[model samples]
Target chain A: MTILATEALTKRYPRVTALDQLTVSVGAGVTGLVGANGAGKSTLIKILLGLVPASEGSARVLGLDPATQGQEIRRSVGYMPEHDCLPPDQSATEFVVHMARMSGLPRTTARERAADTLRHVGLQEERYRPIGGYSTGMKQRVKLAQALVHDPKVIFLDEPTNGLDPQGRDEMLRLVHRIGTEFGISVLVCSHLLGELERVCDHVIVIEGGRLLRSSAIGELTQASQVITVEVEEGLEKLAARLTETGETVAVEGRTLALQVRADETYDLLRDAVVDLDLNLVRLEQRHARIEDVFR
Target chain B: MSQPTGVIHDIGYRHYDGPRLGRGAGAVALWVYSLRGTFGLGRTFKSKIMPFLLFGAMMLPTVVSIAIMALLKQEPMSYTDYAVFMQPIIAIFLAAQSPVLVAPDLRHKVIPLYLSRPVTIVDYIGAKLAAMIAALLILLVVPLTVQFVGEMLIDLPMPLHTHEYLAALGGSVLNAVLLASIGLALASFTPRRGLGVASVIAFYMFTLAASAVLTGVLESEGHRDAASWSILLNPFFLVNAVQANLFGTQPTEGLPFPSGAGPALILLAVVALALTGLYARYRKALAA
Candidate 1:
């Protein structure tokens, strides 16, 4: 079922149109909003949250109109903004509890949920310390904790792994995945990175230049493509030239070669070329289409 | 770094089935949060230092007045006069603490987190204004109550003390309204806490300096009525004028705008203007 949807929605500023007649719908499970900077991703979230009024069209969040019923919509949905929004002087538990209260939770319930949510986000004894001294990953956890403290029906996480290292990113992705699957909360996680979302999201919505580019389930978009990813120990350029000489579609990206498969013979042609050139082959496998391919 | 940290340990995610209150509760929560922050409650030790010191300083003179009244067995100062005389301390409190409600949110860009909740822009503003007003009322009422109790015990003038105490309390409310609205309005303009502090103090100082200079010049020029009106330039005097007129007490500044209820209406207008300024500022801030 559709949890959040915007139809022909437009937001015009004096200098530029932030969202130009954009239309998109997101169902349950983890959905990713992929876009470059200035691609109107943040603007769309603001419109859905009723932070700004749209110039035209209509939208619904959790089946309530954001334009007229923002307060009600916000009560059911949580937003983890991209910017730094944590107060330095406050501890994680204190800030999260206060945010729970802001969502209209009673004091005891707020405190209870804050503790549970902070622990759920992987913050342990450090929850008692001031957030000013927390690392970026920990701060991101606090941001996530606050978003989940009131048990929002749907959570909008903007760049949940924006500042994390590879290891941190993996951990955060796991957390996002659990929130979607284990907790039964619909998730809309926004990020510029495609590969990260490929791991956590069940559906991906690609946007560009304030318009919808594509919206599809992850399995449909990331299926094995007609192109085969060819990685070699050496002779990458020689292999590309040889594949081209054999009348096979081939493209080289850095050390990796992308050879298109026209028929079953495409794989046989690549294997024979590597053996004939006396080059060590590292990998020759069917390529899964990347979410980044949407931009192309 | 604190321990062997990265542990993927999660119990289960429990769904909240408890009662979620409406907008009124959300707004009250914000008010309570802001009010506690005003006096540095639930904050760091360094943050608590200034507010507590100011609270004690505000109460010092009232303590002294009570001591003198107990021993002398005479009227040292009337209850209303304590509020009028303690204007500078209250001004200091307003100037120093108003930014505590707004500055951090602006500087840290946390307003979105707040707006993303059930609270509206007007609810946020109203809660904050209510919080600051409550803090000021506490600062005034505590000392005033102490003096009222001490005087009653020493003199045994129950009816007179109760009447004057209630009058002083009414004046205290006026003082809180005028100071908090104006102070918060000034603080909301600047995002930097230091700058917020400076603007609030500078506004009070400029009005006071202007009022003091004009009052002196007008009195010397024999424009006595103009001198009385000049005191209204400062908001503290504006509240004083209204309070004096309402309770039939003489304004220490000059005549209490002998032209009935006009000063009270004008003071109300200033409060209205300050509130309008705050609303406009936050609306613009939220838009950005």
Candidate 2:
């Protein structure tokens, strides 16, 4: 069963259309909600989380209607919001433990769970210190910890990689990936940058103007256009001429020649083309389309 | 709905990100987080120094009152009269302070955490109001009790007997609760904290000044009793109307200050309506 489904889900603000008839179905595992800023990514996440009511259509999370069943959905779903929300006075231990207790754990159990969760987020030594005293990286970890402390069914992470340094972004992406594949939890992670989602998501849902531009498995998105790129040292003209003579459609794009190939014949054609041309095949790989390519 | 794709492994405390428990448990989790918000303690860290600062500001007058008491000998000021003078001033200060407690959450966008939870908007407003009033009670009402007790210890005539004291406590609590509610309502109207504060003060100014002007004009025109209803239009006047009844003060300018208990009660109802209207507006803005 689809963990989430939306049918023509639309949300309209006074001045902007946040989501415009967006329809998508998400299965288990990490699904990346990919779009640019103002591409309705946050709006979709809000609707899915039942925070913002949709102006049109419908949506469901785990078969519960997000519109009517917001509270029920939120009860089972964890959300790590994009903005910073840590209380300055309380220690991470106190805050997360309080959250754990609010999630219905007993006093002792909540404390244990908070400690365990904070430690799990790599905030062991500093967990007792007030969150205001922590660094941004540490603060981000606390945000992640509170979302996980309750052990929710699925988590909606809106721009988890936002405002992080390169290393922090890498760590956060790895954590997001682990949340799905390693921990076996379903994740709906949103990002405006396409490449980032490509790395961590099993399924990619691209949205524009609050509407679904495309929704497919990550592999499928990269596979639909079978264009193989090849680079050779010198003899590049000969390689293109030889490949053209052999009835392969070839075009010089930058320093490399991009060849349209049938999925099944791509390997055999490349092998014969390389041998026939006496060219040094410095590199050969399939040309993957980027999110930018879709716009172009 | 995905058929529980993986096992619910009990890793005790590993950094895995799966749903740990059930939805019923998640609701409970949000409730606890809501409490943190009520206390002005959240992941954004607004609670620590802010609440204490607010408390200190609200109770500054009490500190001044204590200092004044120490300088005087043999109870020069009647405790009842002095407390009456201080309570309204405290209420005004408390009213001004109430919106500050709520403004940060809206301005900071910290409300998303609560909105994302299984909590409804009503619960959110209720919790905020309760937290603000509770903090005000501690800051404003508690000190009044302490002062009353000190007056008794100083062997001065207790203020208005036990009943009077209870009535005073009740009046203060009502004032705080009503003022805080009004503050929250006003705060909800704007995202700018300054605007919220200014609007609340403006509300107090317009009501009091208008009532005072009308009453002054009425007395000058020899229609003393006609302006009694104007007292119902101002919260301060309405409160004073009740105070006049309780303390048996002489009619100001040959006219009953309270008019009748009926107008004051009616004014309270009107204030309630205005507050409700403000809350509705705020909720709409939040929805937007």
Candidate 3:
């Protein structure tokens, strides 16, 4: 089921068009909003969360229109903003528990939920300390914990891995994946880096210049192409000749030979080419189109 | 990950997973932050003690009065003398120190966290106002109260009277609320701490000086009512003028604006208008 939908939503800032005629339907699981800076990623997320109003068109979050039903939508949807807005004087425990309480939880329940959420986000030891003294990764966890503390049905996390080193990025990505899969929460995670989203996101939506580019499943975007990349130690030209002689199409691409073999005869074709040419096969890889290809 | 050494741990804490605090705790925490921010603590040593120490130095004359009274033969202190000498000094301290309570949060973008939570804009403003008023009360009222009590205990010439005590309390509360509201309204204009502080001080100082000069000019010729209206432009002067009127001690001998209920209601209305304007500007900034 579609958890969120935007019908021809557009938002125009003073100097730039932030989101232009962008229409998208996002369902359950981790749907990645991929774009570079100035790609309207943040604008779309804010609009969906009802923090920002669309200049035109309509959008509904959790079946409530963001225009009029903002407060109701906000009550059910969580948002982790892109910028660092943590109060330096506050501790993680204090911040998250306050958020939970703000979301209408009872005092004891809010405290318990805050503790549990903070632990789950791996911010256990230094949670009592001031956030000003926390590292970048720790601060991000606190931001995440606050968003989760409310126990919203869906979350809009804008650039969750921003400003983190590689290790920190990986750990954050893993946590995001767990939130969608294990915790049973639908997530709309935004990122400028398409490669990272390629791993964790079940569905990918691309935007550029404040407009929608493409939206598809990760599998479809990265589906294996018709060409098979084969590397041989010797007889590269001979293998190409033999493959062509057998009515199979072949071309040399860089250091590897690209071949088009019939679907059923693909394995047998590789076996015969190796035996007849007396060649050593070094590498065999299927040529799949990456999400980056769509950008180009 | 393994925990770092003690020194690193002191500087770099991992996120903790403890029981969270509620609204009361959150307000206390915010109040503490505001207090530390006002005193400029948690940073350089120079900034740490400078604000409070400077304020104490500014109150040297008041301190000297108490010291001399204890050291030598003393006469009864008149209410008029206390109002003229001590009240203005306390007003300066209160007005000058207003922005420190809120400027840091505005500059650091720290207010969003609080606003995004369950707390309303009203509570945020209320807590800040409460902290400033409490500080002012501690500095001004407590000492004055002690003086009033001491006069009764030592059997001074003029013992404490019910009317004097009630009048003083009511007048100070009005002055405190008026000053705090004006201070917050000025502070909302700027996000920089220095700029915010400077603006409030400059606003009060300029208005006080300008109104005094204008009042002098208008009274020397004619149009005393027009001069009374000039007090509307300057909150500090208006507050002082209204308080004088409240106490039946208008400086001008000619046109009396009736300082009793009319001035009080007008002052309250003006304060309410200023507060509403300040809150409107704040909400606009938030939307921006």
Candidate 4:
């Protein structure tokens, strides 16, 4: 299903156009919104959540019009903003429970759900501590817990891994992955790093200068290309010469030979050439196009 | 089909399929939360100090009155005049705590989190204002209630008129709402709690000073009508004027606004203006 759709949505600030005629649709599963700073990623998320109105064009979230059905959309869609928005005076449990109640949960149910969400987000014994004393990663988990406490149909996470060490980033990404796969929640994870989303996102949408650069399934965008890389222990020069002589496009980098695979038999031919040259085959693999490569 | 390898234990992350109360419930929740926040309940000890000190100060006048009535064998003060006597403390409490109700949310940028909920901007403002008004009413009414009860218990020789006492209580409520609306309105404009406190205090003190000076000059010039009209500029005097009108008491000692419908009308107009400014400020804030 198309969970969110924007058609020529535009947001104009006094001195700049934050989002300029951007049009895109996002479906189920985890989708990454990759963009540079000031590329309108935050603007687009704000527009979808109905926090900000578009200067022009129309948009819908979960089949509800943002202009008229903002309250309803917010009730069904969760948003985790990029900045540090946690109230320092409130404990993680208190804050998350308050948010759950704010999302319309009964008091007891809100508490229970808040505890469950905090546990799911990997905040256990420390949930009772005031958020002001929490580490950056723990604070991020609290923010994530509040967004998940209500169990909304979809969530917009803007820079969930904004500040974290490598281990913390990995833990956050794992939780995000589980949220989409295990809980069956649709996620629109926004980040500037395209490589991070390549692991968890099933689809990727690239935006630049407030415009859609590309929107495609991750599999299609990062499909295995026709180029295959072959590396041998010896006879690098001979293998390059032999592969080019067979009308195959080949380029040599160090001891590795990168050749364009012409047919299904291209692998057999490369194997035969390695055997004929009596070279030890070290690595033979097809290069999959990366999401970063598409950005370049 | 192959048997499952891992056990599906209950991690308690169940989906909520129950009836969602939506925006109305959310607004009520916010109201209660903000009400608790006003008293610094569930917050740290440092957060508790200001409210406790202010609340203790508010109760001090009643304690002193009761003590004098009991030990000194003297009638300390009249219940009807309590509000006029307590106006300064009320002003300080309102100025200090109104920011506690509003500024942290804006400073922390948690307004977006609130705005993203089922509630609208108006509901958010309404909840916060309602909480402030409730807090202010408690501060205003509790002292009067204590005074009334203490006087009754002490059995003063004069017959206690219940109607006048009730009228005084009602006037206190009105004064609280008026002061709370104006204080929150001023605090709503700034995100820094210190700035909010300073602005609210400055607003009340400057207006009181300016109006007092203007009223004195006008009275010296023998412009009685102009002096009476000038009292409306100071909210402290305006509240007292309206209360005096309500309780049918003598017009407050130096201020010239009459104890009649004219002062009451000005009081209501000022409250209306303050409330309008509050609503406009929140509307602009949430829209931004």
Q: Per model, how much of the real contact set is kept?
A: 0.93, 0.36, 0.15, 0.70
Score candidate 3 by DockQ.
0.20
Please give, for residues B1-288, the per-residue lDDT of candidate 2 as tens digits: 567767745474354333444444444454445434544565445434555565565456555655555555333233223233554454455445555556656665656665666555666566666666665556556666765565555544433245545555655565556666766777677767678768877777787688779877887888867777765456644554565565554333333664456744764676587568766865774564
**Pick by lDDT: 1 or 4, better one:** 1
TM-scores for chain A over all candidates:
0.93, 0.86, 0.89, 0.93
lDDT of 1 by residue, B41-121 (tens): 898888888889988987898788788887766564577766667777778788889999998898888889989999988
How far off is each candidate at the interface, as Cα RMSD in Å? 0.7, 4.9, 6.9, 1.1
Kindly indicate the candidate among 1 and 3 with the higher TM-score: 1
Task: Give candidate 1 misplaced runs (Cα > 4 Å).
Answer: A231-246, A252-256, A268-280, B1-10, B156-159, B253-256
Best-to-worst ranking by DockQ: 1, 4, 2, 3
lDDT, candidate 3, at A245: 86
Give candidate 2's whole-model lDDT.
0.69
> lDDT score of model 3?
0.72
- The residue ranges of model 4 lying beyond 4 angstroms of the native Cα positions read A8-23, A232-242, A252-256, A272-280, B1-12, B67-76, B259-262
Q: Put down candidate 3 lDDT per residue, B1-288, tens digits, no spaces.
A: 988656422221123244444455556555554555555555345554655764565355545544545555354343323433454555556545676676656766656555444454566777777666666555555545655555555543443454554555555666667777777788877766677767877776787688678877887879778777765455544554566667654333233444556666778897797689778866775665
Error of 4 at A233 (Å): 4.9
Candidate 2 lDDT at B7 equals: 73
lDDT of 4 at A81: 87
Stronger candidate by TM-score (2 vs 3): 2
- Among the numbered candidates, top lDDT falls to 1
How far residue B270's Cα lies from its native spot in candidate 2, in Å, is: 4.6
- Candidate 1 retains true contacts at a fraction of 0.93
Winner on lDDT between 1 and 2 is 1
